[model samples]
Target: MDLRIIWFWMVGILIIGYAILDGFDFGVGILSLFARDEKERRLHMNAIGPVWDGNEVWLLTGGGALFAAFPVVYAAVFSGFYIALMLLLAALIFRAVSFEFRGKVDSSVWRRVWDLAFGIGSLLPAVLFGVAIGNILHGVPIDASGTDVGSFLEMLNPFSIGVGVLSLVLFVMHGAIYLADKSEGDLQTRCRTRASQAWMLFVVLYIVMTIWSWIGSPFLFENSLQNPLFYILFVVLIGAIVFLPIVLKSGKMGRAFLISSLLIAAMLGEMALSLFPRLVPSSIDLSNSLTIYNASSTPLTLKTMLIIALIGIPCVIGYSVFIHYVFRGKIELTEESY
Candidate 1:
């Protein structure tokens, strides 16, 4: 197999890992904001505190893979989405800070401030990430010089906004299911109820976005139709999402979470299939678009990275698996809890 394709799969896998892992992080944070009391808030925070930072490693790994394998795409995307990425970085930074500071002061006022920061921090990234994906799918103004030519705000079209909303709702649902799994008593019931509500909202948004994507960018569906194998993945993705609520209602929290995670993987898989060969589609001129062949580094570089990744990625995965296994099951808060 070509190293280019190998590296592309590596990048995609890392992204999927991040999507499944950090997704719940945002979900928990968003849910925490609506907690009825400090104890409930503490429960929410503790539910994720053990694994949230570890989940972030997937994100970093994905970015690093992109930089190593497709430096041009990395540069083009980062430079184009400069402001948006900065804002995301800011949110993540402050959110991390809130984890430590939210409990530092005994006063309710200080905790409230940090709690708001955590929610906004989590919310911004969730929406912005979807918007970024929307812009990519919708195509951005990229010059032949391989640069994003549009303004930052230009990424906020109606299509992207819709996608952003869907992302937010999707994460909320994911987080709710997680909380429902890890919590008991009234809190567990609330989590389940919120998960149901989020799922309903997600179904509506998903329908709207799918329709909009089909109408606005018929090529997404058309191109998928051209690929028989990928079309199957598309079907499975839709099936998993549609079946999510059923699983939730059946009291299968673990299976429900898997379904949501599968949906994320399948959706990304579909996007990868749609955008295969092309790295970033140029709105200015389709000819100016970046492709795997056009945007990737030298074969030697790719080969070297593939070798390193084959060794390192597994270790990362092993560590992630170990961490999750160690932290598995319900969360219990104590005086020392975050």
Candidate 2:
């Protein structure tokens, strides 16, 4: 097997893992904004408190993998999406600060500002990430030399905006399901109702976005259509779609959330498969796109990095599981507890 191919899948897995774990952290933050009361908001916050910061490690790993395995693509993407990337970083910083310091202050007004900041901070990155991926799918308008020639404003269009909205809705729904699992009493019930209401919207948006991506995304559809393995991926995607409603209707929070996770993983996997070899698809032509083969570092570097990943990923997973198990109960805040 080609090492390039291996690195390609590894990067995809890293990103998907981040999305699955941290996506809920963002969702919980968004939920905090509209929660019934301060205690309810705090419950939402506490549900994710222990793991949210740690969840971001996957992103760092993914980025490092990209820089090590596909340096050219990383450089190009970072440059092309500089403004959006900066915005995401800012949001992350503010969210982290709000999470840490909101309770440190005594004034209600001061804490309220932090609360709102946390909500917006979390919300911005979640939506913008989807938009960034959407832009990738649609193919950024690069020049003849395969470089970014358009301004940031030029990147924002109907397709990318739609994807941003779709991602926000999906994650909010994901968080609601998680909240239902981790909370009790009024908050749990409310979260379930919210999840039920949001699930339909997510379904509609995902379907529409998928269709739009298929028909309108030159980079995604064109390449995938040419691949013989595309049919197999298509079948798996269809299966996930069919399985979703069944799982949701089953009303088992664990099973339903698991299904959601699977659906998201499958979708992201398909997207990666569709653009296989190409890390950043060029708007001009497929030939101009950044492929793993063209962008990869030396074999020595890749081997060393993979070795580190082999040792590191398991440890990370172990710690994550341990933390979840340790805190495995509904978040309740009594006067004394708070």
Best by TM-score: 1
RMSD of each: 1.3, 2.1
- Give the TM-scores of the predictions, in the order they appear: 0.97, 0.93
List model 1 lDDT by residue over 202-304, tens digit each: 8788778878877876656656678887979878998997898888889878888889889889988888778777778887887788888889999989989
Question: Which segments of candidate 1 are over 4 A away from where they belong?
Answer: none
lDDT of 2: 0.82
- Candidate 2 per-residue lDDT over residues 86-203, each given as its tens digit: 9999999999898778888799998899999889988998899798888888877665565776568867888988988988987888888888888777777787788777778987
* TM-score, candidate number 2: 0.93
Residue pairs clashing, model 2: none
Each model's lDDT: 0.87, 0.82
Which 10 consecutive residues of model 2 have the lowest summed lDDT?
Answer: 329-338
Cα TM-score of candidate 1? 0.97
